[model samples]
Target chain A: MHFGPHLLLAALEGLVTSAVLALTALGLSLVFGVMRVVNVAHGEFFMLGAVLAWAITTAIGGHPALGFLAALVIAPLIVGAIALVAERLVLRRLNYNPEATIVATIGMLYIIQQLALTIYGPEARPVEPPFSYRILLPWFGYSGYKLSVIATSALLLIATWLVLTRTKIGLIMRATQYDSETAQAFGIPVGRVYGGVFALGAMLAAIAAALIVPISQAHYLMGQDPLLLSFIVVIIGGLGSLRGTVVAAVLIGLSDGIISMFFSPTLAKIIATLLVAMVLVFRPQGLFGTASR
Target chain B: MTDKNGFFDLSKSTLTRRTALKGLAAGAGLGLAPGFVRYSQAQSSAPIKIGFQSHRTGIGAAYGRWYEKTTAAAVKAINAAGGINGRQVEVIIEDDGTDPGRGAEVVGKFATQHKTDIVFGTLFSHVVIGSAPAAGENKMPYFVVSEGHHVASTKLNRYVFQPGITDVKSQIESMAPWIAANAGKKVTQIFPDFAFGYDHRDYLPPALKAQGADVIAQIAIPPTESSFTKFFPQIPAETEVIYHVMVGPAVLTFVKELGEFYGPNRPQLFGFIDSLEATDINSPGLEFLDGSHFWEGSPRYAQADDSVAQKAYRTAVGIDDNGAAVGDPKDVSTAAHMFGCWETLYVVKKAMEDAGYKGPEDRAKLVEATEALTEFAEGPEHPQGPKTFNGKIHQCFGIQNISKVEGGKLKVVHKTKIEDGLYEAEGDYTTQAL
Candidate 1:
C-alpha cells in the first residue's frame, strides 16, 4: 500500500474504465459523424447486450468460457438487429431530423428499459467471468479478467479504425458524411449507408457492454451511468472525432480514479464536472474536432 | 326537486328540466340501477385504501419489489382474517422513481387524488424525508418502513412514524457490543457518502468506543462509485476489522473488487446486510466473504430454532427456506427489511381498531392511539421479534440479528437484546400539535 504501488493500481483501474468508455463513446461518435443523429437510446442497447449475455450464459450451461464466447458473438448481433429495426421504424420516419430523432431515441430508451425489466426482473445479476485468475503483486492483487478486457477493447478499436479508413464501405460512408446529396447523386445508396452506420454504432456499444458485464453486473438502471459518461466523452473528445473520443476517455477515466483517491468521491465528481464545463467554455469545437465549416 | 322563489318555484317539490336531466345522467354514469343501489348500501363497507409509495423504476427497484410483495401478502392475510374492523384493506400503489422530488409529488397525489386512508411502504431514507413534509401538510398519518433515524430523531413532524423497523442509530448501537467482543477491537469504517451512510459514520464510532474498541480510520465512498480498489489503500494497515455498509446496484462490484484486492489475506470483515440484501452470497466473486459476518434485521436463511410464528410469516410471504420466492430460487428476497412492511401494516390495523377509526375524519384519533402503543409481542403480527415502541420519539427498539456466512448460507450467530439498542429520546413527537 505504498504511494508508488497505489498509484500503479489506480492507473490500472483507470485503464480498465477507459477501455470500456472508449468503445461506448466510439459508437456515439460514429453515429454522429456519419448520420448527424444523437442516439440517446445507445445506452439501452448497451444494457440489452449485457442482459442478453446473462440469459445466454445461463441457458448454455457448460464451461464458463463456452457461454461467454457464445454471448460475445450473439449478443451484439441481436442488439444490432434491434437497433436496425428501431432506426427503420422510428428514426427513418423522422427523416433523421436532429431534434425529432433525439426525442425518438429517448422514447426508445424507456421502451427498452421497461421491456428488460419485465423480462429479466429488477435484480442486478452477475455473469461469471470466462476465467478467474488473480494476479498477486508485491503491493496488491488484481483481476486477470480485467486485464483481458483492456486488451480485447484495444484490438476491437483497431479493427474498427481499419474498417472505417481502409475499406470501400468506409470510403462510401465518408463520402455520404461529407455530402449526402452528392453521394446519393453518385449512386452510393446514401440511405443504406446511414442504416449500416447506425447499426454498426450500436454494435460497438453492445460489444463494450458484453465485455464489461463480467466486471459489473447487469441491472435495469445500469445503463444510466454509462450513458452520462459516454455523452461526456463524446462532447469533450470533439463532436465526431474517433481519435479525440479515445483520448478523452483515457483522460477522464484516469483523472476520475486519481481524483477520487485524494478527495472525497462527491467532491471529485464536482471537480470533474467543473473541468468539463471549463473545456466547453474555452474550446467549443473540442480537442480533436475540426471547426465547423 | 326545485325551491319556490319563482326562480323554479323555490321550495316546491317539482322536478325541473335541469334536475331531471342531471338525475338521468347520474343514474347512467353509476351503471345499472342495481349498481347504484349497491353503492349506497356498501358505503360503510368500502375497503380501507393504503397508498403504497413504491420505488418501482429507480435505483431502489429491487427493494421496492419485495416491499410490494410483503405488503400484498399482509393485506391478503388481514382480509382473510375478517379484515380490520369489518372492512377489507386495499392498497393503491404510486411509483416514486426513488427520486426525492418525485417522492414528494407521489405523497401529494396519494393524499389529494387517491384519497387513501394512510400512506405506507417507503424504504430509502431520502425518499422518506422528501415525502414526510407532504404527509405533515396533508395531516395524513404516514407509516414508513424506512429504518432511518430521521423519524426517530423527531426532526420530522408528528405525522411521520417508524413503528416497525428500529432506526439505524439503534441498529448500529446494538452491533458494537457483539462486534467488539467477537469480531475485532480495531475497526475501520467504509460507508457510502450520503445520508444513509452518514447514520453509520456518525453513530458507530461512539458506540464502538464505549465498548472499548477504537475506530482507527473512516473512508466515505461516493454513492456513484462503481470500482473500489483505489480506496482500499486508504484503510490503515494496523486495522483489525473493516466495517462496511455499502448500498445500491454497484455493491456487487464493490465486493468483487474488494475480494480481488485482498485475496484471502484481509482483515476481519463486518458489514451491514444492507449491502447484499437481495444479492446471492454464493456468487462467484463473493467467495472472499465466506467467513465474514453481517448485521441482519432478520435472518435471511431459516434458522434451526425458528419460532412457529416466524415459520408462518415466511410461508405467508411465499419465501422458501433459503429466503427466496418459492419456486424461484434465483429470485432472492430482501429478507432483512421487507419484514417491516408486514409488521407496520399490523401496527396500523391495531391503531385503527383501538381508535374506532371509521374514515379519514378519525386520522387524528388514530395518531393519538398509535402514540399510546408501548410494546409488541413476537407473534404472527410481529414476526421479526418482540419490540418496545417509544411513542415520544416515534420509533421502535427491537432485537438485532448478527449472522455469519457459512457453507454458502448465512447462519445467525448472535442476537442483541432490545435494551442494548434503547437510547434517550431525542425529542418528543407527542409535544407537537395534531
Candidate 2:
C-alpha cells in the first residue's frame, strides 16, 4: 500500500471514531451545561441504548433493517424516559447540587449496570447491520454500514444543534442554565427544563449507541471506556460547550485512531492523558469555557 | 483455638444448614443431584469450603459467567460422587469485578471472612497474578484455571497452581509448527496488549522460528479497544497469515472490523478461539470467516469423534452440539477455556481425596498431593482429553486442537500430541517452601 491510501484509510477510520465520540460527548456537555450537574451515569445510558437495541432487534425478528429502524426509534425513547424518571426522583431531590448529583449518578451507574447484567446476561451480543454493501475505494473496499454510521451521527449532531438553538424548549433551557432562580422568577418552569435537558442528553447518547451497536456488540461493562473518553473530550473541549465538545472529540478521536494505527494503542492513550494533563495545568477553564464570576 | 464447649464454633466456618441446602439446590440444577440427600444426611461433618474468585463484572464477565457455570457443574458432580473424602464440598463465590486490586481484596475476604479451606477459580491472567500474593500470604492453596504462563514461570507463589490448563507457552509451542505448515510462514500477529497477549507475543515468535516461520509485523491492541480498522493498514503487504488472539467484550467487533478491513481478498487467517469464544459463528457478519481456522483449547462445536465423557459433560453443562445453550441458540458457551474450570475442580477433588483432606489444617497436604498428580486420562473427570501434569511447573500439558471453519461450524482438523507442547520445567514449585 502506498502512503496516500494508508493515510486516507487512517483518516476515514479516525473520522468514524470522531463521529461517535462527538455525539456521546455532546450529550455529556448538554447535561452539564443545562443542569449544572455531572451525569456520572451518562455512559450507562449509552449502554442501555445498545443493549435495548440488541433486545429489540432480537425480539422483533424479520428484516435486519426493520429491526434496526425500530431500535433506532424505540431504544432512545425508552432511555430518555428512564432518564426523565431518574431526574425527577434522584437529581431533583438532590436539588441538582453538583457534588451530591455526582454521587447520585455514580449510584445510578452501578444500579443501571447491575440491572443490565441481570436482564441482558453477561454475554456480548451483536446486532446485524441493516445492510452489507461495501463501497470500493481507490485502495480498498470500506464498510458501507460504517460510512452510514458516520453520516447518521453527523445528521443527529446537526439536529441536536437545531434543537438547542432553534426551538422554544432550547430557549427555556438556555434561560434556566443562565439563571435557574431568575428563570423560575420569570415563570419558566426550571424543574421541567432540567428534566427535559436530562432526558434529551440521555436520548442523544442512546441514539449514538443505537448507531454503533451493529459494529460493537453490547455488553454490561462497555460503558466505562466511553464514559472516560467523553469526560476527557468534555474537559479538553470545555465542559458545557457543545461546539467545543465537537471540536475536542474530533481532535481526540482522530489522534487516537491515527496514533494507534501508526504506533501503538498504549501510545495513543498516553498522548491523550498527557494532553489532558497539559490542559488541566495551563487552561483549567478548558479551551472554549468562559471563566465564571 | 477452639472453645472447650461441647458445641462446635460457628465463627470458624459459615457452613449452616441453609448454605448446605443452597449448595444442594445449585448442584441439582447443575446436574449433580444423585447423592444430595446422602450428603445432607452426613452434613454433621463440616463441608470443605473453596473460595471461588469470579470475574463477574468487568471485561471478563462473559468467560466468568461460563466459568461459574462449569464450576457449579463440577462441584455438583463432586458432591454427587459422595463429596471429597465423604464431606460435601461448598464453593463460596466472590466477584472480583475482574480488577486486580479487588482480586486481592476478594482473596483476603476468602481467607479471613469466608474462611474457605482453599482459594480457587480465577480465569483472567492479571487477576490471578494480583490475587496470588494474597493467597500466598494467607498460605491458602490457590488452584487457578487461567492459561497464563505466570504460574509455571515461577513468577507466582508455590500455592498458585494451574494443574488443569496448559499455559500459553506450551500451547503456542504445540500449535506453531502446525500453523506454519498449514497456514503460512510469514505471519502477522494482532493481540491484546496485556500479560495474556504478551504471552503470545513473546512465545509465538520463537516458536514460529523453530517451525521455520517468521512474524513480519506485530500489532498490540489495547484490550479495551472496540474499533480495529485503524490497525489493519499496518499489516505488511507480504504477510501470508494473520494470527489474532483478542479478548474482552469487543472480540466480535475486532473480528467484524477485521473482516471489513480485508473483505473477500485477505491473507490466510488463523486466530485463537479467544477471538470468538462466546460468539456464534453462524451470526450474520461472520460469514467472511467461513474458511478460516482457529486454535482451540477445546473444540467449541462437538466433533464426530467426541468421547462419551465429553458429551456427558456438555449435557450436564446444558451446552448443545453447536456449543450454544440447549434451548437458547443465541447463548454461546465458552467451550475453549471453561472446560479448564470443570477439570480443575475434579483435580481438586482427586487431590483432596488423595490427601484425605479434612479441613483448612490439611490444605498443605492437599497442595502436595495435587503436585503429585501425573497423567489424567479422558473420562467424565477430564472431558477435555488426556493431560500430563508437571509437578515442577504446576501447569498441565494437554492435547491442543486445531479446528477449521466448515459449514459454519468448527471441525477438528488436527490434534497435537501431549508431548508436542511440553517444554523444560521453568521452576519447581516443589523446591519452594510449602
- On TM-score, the candidate that comes out on top is 1
Please write out the lDDT profile of model 2 over residues B55-82, one tens digit for every residue: 8888888888899888898899889989
Q: What tens-digit string does per-residue lDDT give for candidate 1 at A130-153?
A: 999999999889999999999999
Candidate 2, residue A289: how far the Cα is off, in Å: 3.0
Calculate model 2's interface RMSD in Å.
Answer: 9.2
Error of 1 at B132 (Å): 0.6
TM-score (all chains, Cα) for each model: 0.95, 0.92
| Residue range B37-82, candidate 1, lDDT tens digits | 6547553798898999998878888999999999999999999998
What is the CAPRI rating of model 1's predicted complex? acceptable
Candidate 2 TM-score to native: 0.92
> What residue pairs are clashing in model 1?
B3-B9, B3-B10, B3-B11, B4-B9, B4-B10, B4-B11, B5-B10
Poorly placed runs, candidate 1 (over 4 Å): B1-38
Give the CA lDDT, 0 to 100, for residue A217 in model 1: 91
Candidate 2 chain B least-lDDT 10 residues: B1-10
